[model samples]
Target: MPLGTVLVTGGASGLGAAVVDAVAREGGRPVILDRFPTGSGHDEVCVDLVDARAAEEAVREVSQRVGGLDAVVTCAGTDSCGQFGDVGGEDWDRVVKVNLLGTAAVVRAALPDLEARHGRVVTVASTLGLRVLSDATAYCASKFGVIGFSRALAVETQGRIGVTTLVPGGMHTAFFDGRDEQYKPGPDAKLNQPQDVARAVIFALQQPPGCEVRELVITPSVEGSWP
Candidate 1:
């Protein structure tokens, strides 16, 4: 089937924005749900994903405006760098709330419409979910949870809807902005671009109805080993 309306969480910037533009380029109406202003002409809904009620309302509003929801791409996430021992309980909780719980809210809110349309759900997880890194406990934990969630959801859908988890290694995004030297990786390290992962999401969405792409792990070609 042809592409239809797509809802993207965190679509205001970074990889989410790339996915939004990709969908638009592919003849799909992009409904962006984000905390910041996307400034894109496509339908935009500004709301905090951490707020369950607000997320639900945003999904409802966007789905209503778009006529129907054909796909969802969740790119809303945050990260912190601190040794497991140094990270405080509150910090861990915050990361989980944003990366895990926030995604849960979006999925819950959009599942009904997706079921009706037999659409796709694409989640932007991290390669950290597959491999552990020092001082990235919270990030790894949340992404791991995302992987598990996607797998379970895929099983529950039973081929009715496409569910995919995108695991990208290092990306040249603002995810490292405002970080201390110790908390950030070397800039020279080869990294994947947001557009690279966006393309993967588009690929997953473009597959035929019966096909499902469960997991995609994308890393920089030059980066032979973990960064």
Candidate 2:
């Protein structure tokens, strides 16, 4: 079943973009709330995820434009890769603000519309959220926060709406493009394609009511991140 009026953050690129394409392929409506426009023939609101208030307002605006929201995928994320003390304070804070706080803000504003429409939310966390790594304090912290937030939100929302936390391993995306060589995946390292992972998201979104996909972990067969 196609998700109606789904809003996706960071839907302009990477996994979020893949999910957008998947939703369209499945004949679902995908609206984008991102800092850039997602040219997928869907409505898009250009808003910075790092600003909680702006993120919330963008979500509300999209809900209003679409008439209602049936689902939301919080996929906008940032990272500051360096030893804790080496990373700048502002950069590290932005990672947390965008990945965790922004996710919360979007969902926070969308909840009323979601509850009324019985919508679902899929939050994109990382395998690092489960297993800690060095030189990634900010990313790890934000993702870990996402894990906790998603769990708590599921309980708080209860029957009003559904929430799923997607714990994905390393993927071949531009997420690592500008990172230092040390932060990049090795040549032989296995990583899932964003499109492949997008299928998992589609599956979660298409499940029947009362059968919620509360949590999901998608990783490559040889991915070393997950133990």
Candidate 3:
């Protein structure tokens, strides 16, 4: 089925941008909620995801402008890579607020519209969500929270809304651009392209009614991030 009007957080870049492009290709209208303009000419609600209230408001605003939402893909994410004690408190907390709290707020606000349409939600988690690593306390914590939240939400909204948790491994995007050298992927590191992972998201979204993809883990074939 067509994706209908889908709201995508972080739709300006990375996997989110890829999803937006794919959605358009599949004949779905893509609406964006991001801190920066999408520049894609689609409807957008530009707001920072750190403020849960603002994120919630943005979701509502998008729904109103688009006439309602048929699905939401929460792809907005931030990370502070450092040892628990080394990362500044505010930085660490911001990661949680944006990655975890923001996702909840957006979904919370979209529930009414989504439930009305029996919509789908795809929350972007990470391989870190399934496993642990050193010096990535904030990112790991937030992603792990997403996994738990998505699971419970699926059960809570069973038969009313479809929820899918996407645990993606490293991808080729600017996600690692500003990181310290040590935190960046090695030159030869095999990472899946954002478009590849976006295709998986499309797969999940295309599932017919009464059938849903509860969780998806897409990684590079040789990726060492997962077990």
lDDT (C-alpha, whole model) for all candidates: 0.86, 0.91, 0.94
Ranking by lDDT: 3, 2, 1
lDDT, candidate 2, residue 197? 95
* Residue-by-residue lDDT tens digits, candidate 1, 1-227: 57799999988888998899899988998889898986778898899866777888889887887787999999988887888888788877778877887888888889899999899999878878888878889999999899999899999997678999988887788888887888666868888889888999999999997888898888898873354
Predicted model with the maximum TM-score: 3
* Prediction 1 TM-score vs. true: 0.94
RMSD, one per candidate, in order: 1.6, 0.9, 0.6
At residue 131, candidate 2 shows an lDDT of 91
Runs of candidate 3 exceeding 4 Å displacement: none
Over 4 Å off, model 1: 224-227
Question: Tens-digit lDDT track for model 3 on 70-174?
Answer: 999999999999889999999999999999999999999999999999999999999999999999999999999999999999999999999999999999998
**1-227 per-residue lDDT for model 2 (tens digits):** 75888888999999989998888888888898889875667888999988899888888888888898899998888898999999999999999999999999999999998999888999999998999999999999999999999999999998889899999998889899898899888899899999999999999998888888999999999768886
